[model samples]
Each structure stands twice: as structure tokens, then as C-alpha cells.
Target: MTSPLSVIILAAGKGTRMQSAKPKVLQTLAGKSLLAHVLDTCNQLTVDETIIVHGFGGDQVKSEITNQYTQSSFTWVAQTEQLGTGHAVKVTLSDLPKSGKSLILYGDVPLVSCQTLAALKAANTDGMSMLTLTVDNPFGLGRIKRDQNGNIEAIVEQKDASADEQNIREINSGIYCVDNALLHKYLPELSNNNAQQEYYLTDIVKMAVADGITIVAIEPEHTFEIEGVNNRQQLASLERTWQRKVVADLQEAGVQFADPTRVDIRGSLSAGQDVFIDVNVVFEGDCTLGDNVYIEAGCVIKNAQIGNACYIKPYCVIDRADIGAGVDIGPFAHLRPDTVLSDNSKVGNFVEIKKSTIGQGSKVNHLSYIGDATVGTGVNVGAGVITCNYDGVNKSQTIIGDNAFIGSNASLVAPVTIGDTATIAAGSVITKDVDSSALAFGRARQVQKNDFQRPTKK
Candidate 1:
């Protein structure tokens, strides 16, 4: 039988270089905290227990993680002193089960894939394994030292390395997978005798080598998987790298983009075949686009479902809306929450819809505000139309029946209904209900005067 796995995430750093009050792991990349990314990745693995070691901003870290992951179980360990990485893991030892294997991870290195971690865990056949990388410049990093027979020996930190050891190209990624029994045995024996006078987790490599254990080194498929964020610059760089990967995956799934670099997806975005997304578009909070849907530049869509063949013009904001097939919306329109557009409906420029249902074949073709209303099928709402659905304190609903024609600059006061085939004259404000096939003119007629004297300019 396979032993269970435990994951230990180190997230105690203050990240002084980042110049922020929040903890380093609380810093955001791709609209999520750095630690959130790591926790999300750990959720994909078969982890028996998750232990997080926190130092600075411990309460904030615990609160955030607890609130975000209410369903997942986690053990929070506080490191009172900021000794080193070795000490960080040492704090989590009390919560770790001693029979299975444990995987050590860093919260700031948020892009590590689950596949790489699983491979690292599987490589721990002889109780010890670690992730390593070979780079062009290994300066200021811990170098992996090997014996004369090319067998793994130890890890030499940059400050303690000799001149010959400093030139090694392979560096330690500081990620390790070890047997829980060995961790309990070796972690307590670690000493702060290095040049930095702090316990180094890499020192365990030497201890394993002395006991005749072969240390397996596994490298991730991408270098960015091991990248750590220390400052805002590195955070931004990783953000772009992550976004590039997201765009690449979408492209592979047959989504077309005008300029992939100009788009930002803060949350989940799913697109069907033949979807064309233009530049500077932002998608947030679970948006879905069907086949042949065309989205123009500078549109923000959030938590909305757009049906097949829908055309969204430039600078539109759609939130929590369900749009039917063949619907056309704005060059500059706002469809707020609870708005539904039926098939073949058209919402033209500078229109705003809120809590309303526009029926099939209906056209609201100009500047208008339709809120708390139901517009019937084949209805035509002219320019500058307004549904007066609010009365300072309470909101009411306006219902327009089938084939209703509302003229330009008209206001239909709510708690009213316009019947089937009804016509509302231009610039009229109807406060009462109009019967079927009736013509409602709320404007007063012009009165003629026989003679009037004109006043001269002062």
C-alpha cells in the first residue's frame, strides 16, 4: 500500500523588498494571493495533511487562509523567531504524521505544478529527494555539491562555498520530499554553525549522504515553477509569465485572440469554438462565451453567460446577465445584474439595463434606461426612453405588452402597463396604464394666442 503524503508550506517572510505591510505570501499575482496559489495547487494532490508555518503577520495569514478554505483542513504553526528555512519546517514537525512522506514547499513560489510535485514525491524511494535547477548564473544561490564519483554529497550556500564550489551551475531549489521518520530524526540534529549562523534546510542533504542514502534530484518542466517573489518587480514578471501560460493554453484549445498580450482574465473564462476576443478585454468571475461570439475592445464581462453568435461591441460592461443567441449589445452599454436579453434582441449605444427582461425581437436602439421592467416581444423602445421604476424609496415595475411602440424621449411611470399594440407618442410621460391598441399622449396641446407683443433686448 502507498503511504499518505503531507505538505508543509513555508510562508513566514516579511518581504522587506516588497515594501508592503502585508506578509510576503499575501502579495498578489494573477488576482490571487501568492499563498492562495500554492494552497490551490496542494488541493490537487493527495495530501493527507497540510501544515503552514507562519511568522510575520501570522494572525492575518491564518485568518485569510481559514476564511478562504473553510472546507479544507490545515494546521497552522507559528515560528516565534525568524531563524531560517530549516527552523520554519522544524515548527511544523509536531503536526506531521511520522509514517508517511512529507513534501516541503514555499508559498512565494506559487507557480509549481502538481505534476512536478507528484514526480518529486515519487522519486523519494530511499527516504530523501529534492528539486534542483541548472541555470546560467548560480550566484547568490545554494550550489549542489557532488562527490568525486558524481554522487550527491551536500548543498553549499553562496556565503559558505569555496572558490571552486562557487562555480557550480546546478543550484538547489530549496524544495524537498523526505520520509516523515527521517525528518523527525534529522531536523532536531540541525545546527546553526553555518556562515550565516542560522539553520539551513539544505544541511539535511549532507546528513542523508553520511547515512549512505542516495538523494534523487528532480527538475521541474519549467523554470518559472521554482521562481520566488521577493519584490514587486519579480511579482510583476511572474504575473506576465503566468498570463502567457494561460493564453497559450487557451490558444491550444482553439480560442482566437486579436492581441493575446493585451487581454486580462482575472477569473475563470471559458470559450467555445470560433470565439474571437479583441484587445484590452477583461473577463472576471466565471464568464462563458459560446461559439461564434465576437467581443470587441475594452469590454468587461463578469459572471455572465453569452449565447452563441452574440456580438458585444466596444466598451461594454456586462455583469450577471444571461443573453440569448443572436443578441447584439452596445458600443457603449451597461447591462447590470439580473438583465436578460432574448434572441434577436438589440441594445444599442449608451443604453443601461437593470433587472429587466427584453423579449425576443425587441429593440432598445438608443440612449435609454430600462430598469425593473419587462419589455414584450417585437417592442420598439425609441431614443431617450426611460422606465420610471423608482419612487425615491421603493421600486416598482413597468410592463409593456407585445408589439408595443414607445416613442422618443418618453417616460413610462411605473405601476403602469402599456397593452398590446399600444403606441406612446414622442416626448410624452404616461403616468397611467394604456389599453390595448390605444394611443396615449401625456403631453399637453399647444394653445394659440391672437396677438402678442415681443420685448426688445435690454
Candidate 2:
């Protein structure tokens, strides 16, 4: 509830271990780029100002973010060189005001909680508050050097630590909440005096301690919250960690998971009570599930909302779709953009619905493509039925009234309609609208051939 804070995320690493053409920060975990996760976390913290310091693939990173978050209040900072972590922050932090403190994070470590960050902000005072934790082996990490009273004195890197310091468990997590005014005052004085010729942010702790400024070291709520992703293996490990954590959270919220490990939720997923999610479900973008919704395994839903009691079967891809209550979708269905199904409607296996609106209790079952159509209630669309929505020139629509029955192998060429209770016979191609209770069969009647003669072979 304090004033919105500033945030700077370092995302400059090339991530050579990933062996990928794309930058590490641009690698996707749970369907979003790694840096997007960090930016989203910052937004969740109500950070007034956020900056992304990009080094490797900086242009692509900036373009992707700009395309995705057109209205977000964030500044993109470019770091041309692959400098140390301290130099990465220093170069891009110019956009921030010199007066307010900031919460710094790494783009590769995206699962940090805002609650922990808020606690760090609460501990931020005259100097800085670092997100610290004790590990079993702090050999390569900078040890947290404290005074007799247990106050953080200085941080010593692995090579700089003495024999006694090697046994110390508490270490720097590389995440901090520092006083911006003080940081700005001493930033220019930072020198590349280390063996690697890289500036050290840890030096600020010594400066603050010598000047009698307070430095607080708060432990992270979860140890994995600060874990960094260096390769595909690590990225995948963290992705699973984040997904499993979300599954656990949802399980606590009364969501029944068929197989927790197989589900992947990329963006925000809000579920009502009694929602059931099956295995291998990848939910991207934003999705909302109403009460009693049953999602079967291998369902990929995105930018879609499922109504109460809707059953989404296996291998269903619902994107940019909206389903009403009691709807049943697919064992193999693709509900594309602008598709909407009313209550009690059914789209069975091998069915694809695009830019169509199916009315209540309608059925489009098996081997069908219903695009650019408006179907009324109680419509029975048999197997292998298709609405020929696309002509050589432009797309068209097929309108069917209530209780209309379209038989198997029927192709209803659009800009066409069928009146209420009209029946189209099997293998019919409907090119014009039919009247109520009429039987429309556009195909020619059967003609028998007799006495067929065989021709001589060439």
C-alpha cells in the first residue's frame, strides 16, 4: 500500500548454454517469454516505473514487448555490452528518478513473488534491503558478512572470502531494494577493480556500512524464487516449478486436477468452484472457467471462457472462443476465433467451427466445418456436413432456422439459409434457401445405366 516503487530487471545475458538462436530472456516458459514474466511480476507489485535492461537480442526483445504491452508504463533500456550484473543495472537506471528506491530482479528468474518484494520494500530504509537466504553450499556465492550483532556488514564474493567465511551459509541473492538517491550518488564512483574487471554492486553494502547507513537482509519466502535459468534444462525445470506451483494453488482452491504435472497455464486462469482440469491442458492467454466445468485431457484453450457445466473433451483447441452452459466440445474440435456456442450445443469429433454462432441445443457432430454461419436451436447437423463459406471472391454465411436437419455429406454453399424445421436430404448441396417444413435436395436424382460396353485397350 506504500507509494508505487520503481523496478529494474536485468535481462542482458546471451544464455550460451541454451544453444538457441533467441536470447535467454526471450525464451518462453509457460507460453510467455521469460522477461514477460518478470515484467508481469513488477506490474503485480504495483511498481510505478519499470525498466528492462536488454543486451543480447535487445531490438527483438524491445519489439516483442512493445507489440504485446502497448499501454504499459515501462521504459526499455539497451545495454550494448555484456557487462557484469552491476554494470547492467547502472547503464539502464538513468530513466528512474534519483529520489525513489527500486526493486531489482533478474529476467531469467521470473517466479519471484510480489508479496516477498513488498516485504523487502517495507524493510527498505535509509540504505537498502536485499532478498537474502542461507544455502547448504555458498562456495561460489558472495557470503553475507555480518557484525557481532547479526547486522549485514558487507558481502564477500567466493574468491574474496576467507576460510572461515566459506562456512557461512547466508549469501547474496542478487535481488535488492536500494535507496535510489544514495545509489545515484555513489554509482559513478563504482570502479572495475575486480580481477574480472567488472564493477560490483556488493560494494554498495560496504559504502553504506562505513557511512553508518542501515542494510537489511530479508530471506526470500521460497528458495526457488531467486533461481536463475541458464539453459533449456533449467528453463524447463523452472517452468515445471511454476506450473506445478500454480496447480497446487488451484488444487487448494477446489479445482480437481486429473494430472497436475501435465497441465500448463501460461497466462491468468480463474476457475470457479468445482472446476475439473484434466491432463496435458495448455491454457494460454486469459481463460475463465465457470463452476462444474469439466476439461478433459489434451485440451488447449486460449482467449476463451467456458461457461458453467461445459465439458471440453480431449484434443480440443478453443481459441478466441466463448461457450455457453452445458456445451460439449470435441474429442477433436477446433473452435477458432469469433466462434460462440450457445447453451446445450454440441461440437463433436473432427469438427471445426470458425466465426460461427451455434444456437441452443444445436448439434454439429463429426467431420464438419461450420464457418461464417448462424445456426438456430435444435438444429441437427449430421456427419460430413460443411458450410461452404468461402467462394472464389469472398466469404459468405449459412443461416439455419430452428429444428432444421442437415444430413450427412451435405455441403451448404453460403449465402444460403434453411427455414424452420426444413430437412436437407443426404448428399445434398444447398445453394438456395428453403421454406418451412420443405425438403431441399439440390443434387440430381439417381439415373440408372444399362448395357455398358467395354472399350478396347490401347
Task: Identify the candidate with maximal lDDT.
Answer: 1
Off by over 4 Å in 1: 415-420, 430-457
Error of 1 at 219 (Å): 1.4
TM-score per prediction, in order, is 0.90, 0.95
lDDT of 2 by residue, 31-118 (tens): 8998888887777776778888888888888888889898896688888886577788788656878777888899898878888888
Candidate 2 lDDT at 57 equals: 86
Regions more than 4 Å wrong, model 2? 1-4, 450-458
Q: Summarize candidate 1's per-residue lDDT along 63-113 as a digit string, tens digits.
A: 998999999989899999999999999888889898999999998999999
Best-fitting candidate, scored by TM-score: 2
